[model samples]
Target: MDTPQNTALTRALTELPGPLPARGVIHIVIPHTDRFTVVGNHLAQHAGLSTVAVGLAVRIQSLPQGTEIGIKALAARFPEGEKLIAAALRELEAHGYLRRAVTNLPNGRIVTRTVFCNQPTALLRPRVVAQRPAPPQTSPPAQDPAPEPPAPEAAAAPQAPALPDVQQEQEPEAPAPLEQEPEAPAPAPQDHAPFVARVPPPTAPRQPPPPLPQPRELTAELDRAATALLSDLRRHARQLVLSENDIRQLAPAVAAWLERDTHPDTIRHTLTNDLPQPLRHPAKLLKHRLTVLLPPPLPGADDLAAPARPRIAVTPFQTCDGCERAFRAPTPGHCRDCRNAHAHGPAQAAA
Candidate 1:
């Protein structure tokens, strides 16, 4: 079972110049740890170094020295078969793990090589947690949980002390009243008020409310970054941060804090939500498109250059309200069903 090539490959991985069990192998294995899930999920797709497959590749060597090992040889001895092994290694390298150091083997052919890696190639994950079965499902009943004890029947409200219905006191029908004709009286008050000219009270004008504080304007570049990050995060659980906004609402105070106070690399300004579905994690759609609103103020830009006019963008609002479906602004308001329902309140109201 130990051909010279096989033996050399095994020896390279096992004797990798490292100090951990299965020495050189941990570079491949450690990344698969829970510590790197976010970056791991991102990389496996974009670059391929998902830790599970990569870690197993390294661990198979069981060496304890330097992690300097020939990748071709490691690939050969991997437990998960060479095809997946090469795939993982290629993925790892593409995602910026061990660089490709070409080493000339004794046969004078250039062989691909791998260097030991102790640092992560992608975003930071202080610790990667291994997946474990959810702690024995103590979650309350999915349906029909234990019935709540019946609330004690409210003590019958004390019967209003029965005041005998007063009206039942049959006042013997009042004896019939006599009828009589009356004489007309003369008018006299008009002249008294005439001298006091009819006075009308003065009306006071109402004050307008103070306007809401204006938010900082966002920039186009900020919008691009926000959208890119949103798409990047979607691969992971939405709970991890799925949907993102266009990035325009951040107030100046908040934008300064996000750019200056937060860690340079950590998520700065973000909002998230939980959604219902097979995609169990909540999807967080961004509220304000941020990218356009966060950059340094542009020189000589003015939003108010013309005479005031009421120009309401009723399209997106109308779609969200009337169609019950999300649509970009400027959707002709002409979806077939929408046309059929045009008689609905908003369409008719806007028209």
Candidate 2:
């Protein structure tokens, strides 16, 4: 449960005066609207202010400690036109959503950071739900055993002649037979070495594993598409230096793109998995892409085995331990405050 002070604080944050724009209409974030339409200094202020408010409140509500609020994330969430946001920013500055501001340039747009002074109400705790045990069930009482089944009526017994008991007894008494000898046990087989086991001699010549099965090749359309992909790859490979995987994506796609008989998903898998080298070589750019992004080999294909890439430099950014804040790197490989905080982790800083 939140303390009374915290609850009061959560309630105090106000909603914007009027109803917000209707859901599903063109807002800046949706791709449909021309992103650059908002013009003039006044409209720009509205665009900036409205968009900033949306960015600031939501960002504070979702803020991660020690991380900066990036402009791209804010722009992505903006509902109003950006130029209108610029105009609204002045109003917000007069009101109080943003305080001391800083900004950066991205994709040619100047983006500002709105440093938060207080936590937003949206971050407040939600009501808790309690779990309860289920009720027990009862069954009906036991009953007496069922009655026994009826028996069949017996037939009259047949009469037999009395006779030969004396003769039968005399015949049995004539002799007692001797018992037969028991059979001998069979010999045990010798054991082989622990590691030795009979294995078949090599049957087929060594080769790469067969490619993963493709979509039904029985269809005429699949054959046509396969041919096209092979041709495209040949063109692509001869002209460009594909790494091999890219060629695979193109090959199956040709079949998929041309074959009305195949589903897009199946075509995609075929193109990506068992595409022929003839088509693959021409699309060297794709091979380069796949080589970089996917280092592992495709099923039943060559190991790809590209060489190790050059190392990249990562410059450290400044961090404020007191408030758990990190600003973008203004310089390379050093964060002054985090280093100076006197709370250095046991591990020594890199030389």
Candidate 3:
């Protein structure tokens, strides 16, 4: 029988004395009766995932179906910026905790479908069912036939005369065993060589794209213009900041564009407009754009001849001295009628 003092002493030893020590995390879990989400240890204690990714995954799981979990929405709700949120989402996707797929609807609308997996490992691994050995088949024991009823007692019959015992006279000797023939030795098995698979010859390596065309002659003015344009690209778009080496390497390509009558503004717009987010290789992108969007050289004047226009001469107006009459003449002089009258007057006077 246990005493009260012993029981009390045992309880005191097992129970904690005061507040818990500040060491690692200690849970005082209170079960939620309603509105509780179940999180697996795979996600909560994953070694590969960052804390942000783990928290983001949990938040996504707790939300109701069809809720917006886009980068912008998450960024608005949480303190993290869009870049960090996007990075966390990518991490989750890489580790199989989340999946996003684009689907096109019949009505021509595109939508993204998101799926969250609680146990990614379990989902990925294949399930196996163990097969048990079958029990040995047994047959039922056979029963003996029922004993026949005892037959009536039969009458005694006379015994026949006794014959001489074969054993007592002479036992016939057992026949001699037949002589056994010697067995022939078996032939040895032949060793089979392993099959050698013939490998096909390696295919030719893929060729890289051709280099961008450069200007025939890089003049000082053209070089300065191209360099200035490339250096100023960062003002329009921050992501397009190019280094000195990049500017130098790409100056010739830009000079080619300038030589072909392509404006600096047009080049800048082509490089900076509608850029993809998180541009990784700015130099390579600019190089490709410069090559593809290069303008054709201006046509020569001789090749594109303009049509000749006809010329019309305009006469000047003059006022006659004798009469105030306006007439078209080369110089300031009398009208045609006035001149004819003067000539006739002189002839009349002479006559």
- Expressed as tens digits, the lDDT of each residue in 1-351 for candidate 2 is 555566543443333344334344422232445423322343234444555554444444455564543444444555556555555444445645445455657767765556553322222435334334344454877898997765443334454566866544444465667866655545433332234435878899798533323343436756555544454443423434444454455454344344334444443343355444334233543433333332222334244566579998776666654555776675433346665654466445542
In the range 1-351, model 3's lDDT, one tens digit per residue, is 455567655565447455554456544445799998999987999999999999999999999998899999999999999999999999999999889999999999999988888778666544544445455576988999998875454334545666766434578899999977755545433233334556877798987866886998999999999999999999999999899999999999999999988888888899999887658789999999988877889999987998778888989999998787999998998999999999999999999
Model 1 TM-score, 2 decimals: 0.19
Q: What is the C-alpha local distance difference test score of candidate 2?
A: 0.46
Off by over 4 Å in 1: 1-48, 57-63, 67-72, 75-77, 104-112, 120-351
RMSD of 3: 23.9
Query: Which candidate comes out best when scored by TM-score?
Result: 3
Deviation in Å, model 2, residue 297 alpha carbon: 32
Model 1 gets an lDDT of 0.47
Each prediction's whole-model lDDT (CA): 0.47, 0.46, 0.85
Positional deviation of 198 in candidate 3, in angstroms? 20
lDDT, residue 81, model 3:
97
In model 3, where do residues sit more than 4 Å from their true spots? 1-205, 306-351
- How many residue pairs clash (N, CA or C atoms closer than 3 angstroms) in each of the candidate models, in the order given? 37, 32, 0
Q: Pick the winner on TM-score between candidates 1 and 3.
A: 3
Q: Which candidate comes out best when scored by lDDT? A: 3
